[model samples]
Target: MVNIILAIVLLIILPYIGLWKLFEKAGRPGWEGVIPFYNIYGMLKLSGRPTWWLVMILVPGLNILVMIGITVDFVKSYGKFKLVDHIAAVALAFIFLPKWGFDKDTKYTGPSASPEFREKYKIALKKTPAREWADAIIFAVIAATLIRTLFIEAYVIPSASMESSLLIGDYLFVSKVNYGARLPMTPVAFPFAHHTMPLIGTKAYWDGIELPYYRLPGLSDVKKGDVVVFNYPMDADSPLYRPVDKRENYIKRCQGTPGDTLSVVDAQVFINGKAAITPLNGEMKYTVQSDGSEINPQLINDLHLSDLTPVNNTSFKMNATVLSVKALKGYSNIKSISPDITPKGHADPLNTVYPELFPNYKITPNFPDFKWNVDNYGPIIVPKRGWTVKLDSLTFPVYGRAIEIYEGNKVQVVGKDILINGQKADSYTFKLNYYFMMGDNRHNSEDSRFWGFVPEDHIVGKALFIWMSIDDNASFLSKIRWSRLFNIIR
Candidate 1:
């Protein structure tokens, strides 16, 4: 509260003080510069600009661009048209205006923006080549940074979780505008580094000036099947504290939207009691049995079947896409090929169980006998904003992590009751919407079924296009996946 009050006071007082002195230096009544809209009018008159520019500054989004142009003109009116001067005009205006207006060495010379005035002063204020290059690079970084924050950014597929749909080494251009670009929570950070500072292996960002989660207007709403990029919410504090936007980025298909009931039966996803349509090209593990002879290696390459594990030579387990599964059936040496699906009621073998699955079913009593596994998971409803859910021993395990960690509330389970922040509570009203995300590689991917729901605040953007694709296994001539380049990601 005190910080907010201090910021408000500074916003009100600093501009008034700086602009008053600036107008005085321009031969106008200093008090006239402190009067809201009138101050803008005075500024325009001194810079030889029309009053219509003020209207242009009032429009949303465009106001920022128009105001920057006006500031450049104002700085030029004082005979400071250098790149550094323009940067000071835009970024340090509150301080720079006061310095320029009060300094005895700086004097107003009718606007220097005019070509005649620039040419006359060019010799005395000319910049060296090195300095000019530095200035250009600085400005370019700023422009690119703004576009990355507000429009789109390039991302690369770091893993094969979304195999066949999105592959490893595929370079993508993620569109932040699809689900609205999130304003960076921790704005001061090492450029181009996500979590670690380059070369140092230390933290990249400062959390001192953290901002609340905010998103700009977006092009479209996130839908059921859209491939979405989002911050890995689980990594918020695996080893160190990090802001929301700086967490690792993970891409997956949106399996369930808020308020939708979602479940997995025999490795197939279902939403609202109906089987969700799987992506046609999605890959899943399948057990393949061949005739008593070594399977042809060329056929395996043609089908793109990989990660083959031999089961007595005659049979093997491999991750294969739908098209690959169809082609494998046509091979004379192949006897049988079927999906490696776990039975609905059975638990995975002790060696195959992933202990980190959500709700951590291993904790007893709080979650007595949770038979749910990756293949036959919940009919749990995704939480929506303002929806209230009753809390008890049974329900607590399902949402305990969400309320305590993500929502930042203190929770306790006392016998049959639940306490939130030391107060006995029967229910919890979700503060944010949640979605279910999963990789296209059904049996191979680790996603929401393993970690849990993705809170709305963690959403990053829509996966738009694959700008480039490289195949590590291919020889030089075919190293580039020519067909995949420039393809729009569905």
Candidate 2:
């Protein structure tokens, strides 16, 4: 809040203070310059622009361009027509405005935007080709930046976490408007780069300036079964302490919306007390037993089976989609295929080896007897905006990081008591909603079962469709996956 106030003072108030002096020099009342919207009205009148431009300045994305145009015209009215002076007037307004306002040599010449002034100084105002190119480039950058930030952005599937639902090589257009375009929390950033600059491998943004979380009104709230892209929650900790918007993006299917109690039993997700809809093309690890005959390599390729390992001549392990499993069952040599589910009482080998990978492992009073694995884990309630939860050793591990780090509350455990914001609290109400996200590649995904819930502010957009698909391992002639292109994401 203090930062916001300081930004307003520096960016707005200080420039208006200089405008007060400039207005006095133009034979207008000095007070008119500092009166917010009225000051803009006064500037339009002085610069001979239509009063309707004030409406344009009030708009969100368009307001940026309108203000720049107005500033340039206002500077030209003061007989400062050089491109450098216009640049300084708009970019370094806090310093340049006051400098020009107090300079005795800087005097009001004429309304630069008016027809009469342009007609009188037509030759002097005529733009050169280089100047025209510079103007065009500047306009393009500002316009493109606004579109990318508020409308839609292009993203590529870098990993197979989304699997057959969204392939590894698919190029997608994620619509920011689907879940409301989130206003940039870290406002000052490189125009095109996300978190880091390419080639240089350095930070692309200055995190010194930040804004509070806000989103424009959107088509609808995030729903269960939606393919969503969001900033990785774990990036908020340790070595990569990126700002919320700048964290690495990961796409997954939203299995549980806010306030839904989600759990996975024997690799099948259950919401509340009912079975949830599974992804049609989602893959699962399975153990396959075959008649003592070698499986055809062509059959393996055709089924898109992955991670195939021979346990013996007749036994094999592989990851396959439900459709693939059914297709493989048609073969005479295949004996049986069973889902490789971990029993309820046991933890997954990976989770057991790296306990810290599980979200709940960090709690002080650990659940020594609660051995939950990826395939048989969680009846945990997802956090809702206003829902309150009791703070105890058992529940702390599930919700502590959210309360302490995500919500910006100082939490400490003193013996058996939990202290929130230096006060003893038995419960805490969530300020933001959270969703449980999981990958379609069930056994291979490191998701909510590992990192915990994704905060609402971390959500980026919905995966709209695939615009292109490339099969990197294919021959040059078969490089493009034609069937996958333009497929709408389910």
Candidate 3:
């Protein structure tokens, strides 16, 4: 994970210091580094390099190669070259320049890199020989692991499903404290790679602790209205594929805590008849996409809504619409209007949210499982061993699982398709237990809506803080949003 830290430091932390050195090293004013592309030219000439090098450096592959060489030469000239100097060349640009120029009190009196500077730079890194790759890999792995597990983990908001609550370009810090944290399920999380899976799952009360999140401690429990980041309930997405800070860990409000009966009527939220305080967590206004497509901006404006609000373009259902309902579309209603005022003026009445109320029903579990929806599945009273279940009481055509009561890890399968313990059972109880987790962006998310609840076995950790975030369009330098800099995830 040291590499991860280095990457951050070099990319973020070092620049401030390096920019100063860049000015001094160039023999120009210290503020030169703080300027735009001028620093590139300044550093190039300081190292006895050419202005053309800056243009080539802007090129993808060529720039990377040039930077590696320049870094070592730059630092050695500044007098910091040592065992770690090669890494400075390979990994540090911002650090080397500032430390050499501004910090070291050097001044840029030249137009470009001097021939002597380039020669010395090559010699410095060349002396280290084969250890370059090894050092870089070792440190990066250590940093990635530590950061991925205990500290804040970064993620991106993907779909517009959570339009009003999050934007496609938004990066977030998922606090792990809201839910009890889960130790690494997989023993060794290989740096930059997924090698193995962990053994013990989280406690029934500790699900969603899987990936990095808000839980700094293992004592907290996730409650309704709490925003959360969990493994995608569906398999269509992968966090790794997302951008470094933009990885897809959906940010959605917790509509239903475990065992909460979530429903919608006409559009307003009525929990056991009491209205739920309207939340802006699942709401947003419209904006244009980069592709020029019109859609909800998925922004969390910290604003409220009023009656007669209208929105469309995605799917939504009022999980808790205790407020007023105006224009309605598939599953979504307006939770916000022009600027402020929530549909519901009162705070969310936090209370126990139970599962859908249903009478006793029968089921025939098909082996290997069959296609089924959580809404229409047969309501099977959890079949305990002593309670006799009958074959005639089964409802068929649902997903099937072979009835296998095992001693430890081995479960026995009776038939490809059969009833459980004599009666039809929908879900099988585990030696541990299972959990149901769904994204608040109900329709747009690929969550438990498809694959089913997260078994206690798959939880990771709670998200904590947003370290960094930038959009695809923002400048590498212009994108840091200070308002989100250290905001807490409630």
Best by TM-score: 2
Query: For model 3, how does the per-residue alpha-carbon lDDT over 18-71 read when each residue is reduced to its tens digit?
Result: 666555554567776666677666666565565677777775334545665665
**Which pairs clash (backbone N, Cα, C closer than 3 Å) in model 1?**
none
TM-score of 1: 0.86
The reply for model 3, stretches above 4 Å from the true place, is 1-140, 176-181, 194-217, 233-251, 267-278, 284-443, 465-469, 473-485
**Candidate 1: tens digits of C-alpha lDDT, residues 1-490:** 4434544444456657877887788788999888987887777777777888889877644566677777777777787767888888776666787788788877667654556666777874588998789877975776677678778899999888898899899999998888888877776687778888878798888765566677888877789999999988778656755677888889999999999999999878899999999998788889988886776889878777878988785888999998989888997988999988777667654214466366666753556555676678888888888989998767777777778777878888787778899999999999988889999987777788877888888999999999999988899999999999999998
Candidate 1 Cα errors over 4 Å, as ranges: 1-46, 50-66, 75-126, 349-356, 363-365, 414-416
Question: For each candidate, what TM-score against the reference?
Answer: 0.86, 0.92, 0.41
- The 10-residue segment with the lowest total lDDT in model 1: 348-357
Residue 412 of model 1 has an lDDT of 81
Which is the winner by TM-score between candidate 2 and candidate 3?
Answer: 2
Q: Is candidate 1 or candidate 2 better by lDDT?
A: 2
Clashes (N, CA, C under 3 Å) per candidate:
0, 0, 89
Candidate 2 global TM-score:
0.92
